[model samples]
Target: MSTKRYCLTCDLKDDEALIAEYKEYHKSVWPEIITSIKEAGIVDMQIYLSGNRMFMIMECDETFDPVKKAEMDANNPKVQEWEQLMWKYQQGLPWAKPGEKWIEMEKVFQL
Candidate 1:
């Protein structure tokens, strides 16, 4: 099976204590969230932090449809709860739409 990779970025409120708390929460994400991700066809995911900036890498199967995933998430109470909790620490990029988080990054280079 072919895998597609996507990179996304977001920002955290520039508060040290809040950032620490955010990391702690990630250390024990709700199991339902993990299952939801896999059910969305996301085979692998990783997140990295730099200062107040955050980046995520996701590898998904061909079956992954972002729109479908959004619909599924909307119907899942656990996912909605997780998103609401995450917003405490996450902020949209400067150019992001009013409700957008994790903006997708453009790939400008490849070896």
Candidate 2:
């Protein structure tokens, strides 16, 4: 398995609401969304949050491409829906571009 790490950040304000929404929605992530993720070659995925920052860790096959995964997400209706709903509880950093809910982080170290 190939392991990779990515990062994203949201706002700490309304963290309770954000966590609640995350828990609630994850209880039933749409089938298509799950399929899309798996199909994109993601073997395992996890997100960790502290303050308002989120760190995403993913393990995937050699075929995984972050660019392709993003394209698939953009074209998937379920993903769009989920993102829209999530935005209700989350806030983006001031530097985030318009319409961007999550800002990807730079990878600086790996062990």
Candidates in order have lDDT scores of 0.96, 0.74
- Over the stretch 6-59, how does candidate 1's per-residue lDDT look in tens digits? 999999999999999999999998999999999999999999999999999999
Which ranges in model 1 have alpha carbons more than 4 Å from their true place? none
Q: Estimate each model's TM-score.
A: 0.98, 0.75
**Candidate 2 CA-lDDT value:** 0.74
CA lDDT of 48 in candidate 1?
Answer: 98
Query: Which residue window of length 10 is worst by lDDT in model 1?
Result: 96-105
Question: Tens-digit lDDT track for model 2 on 1-111?
Answer: 656654566664456766776767778888887898899988887777776566666677888898898898999888888777777767667898887766777878779
Best by lDDT: 1
RMSD of 2: 2.5
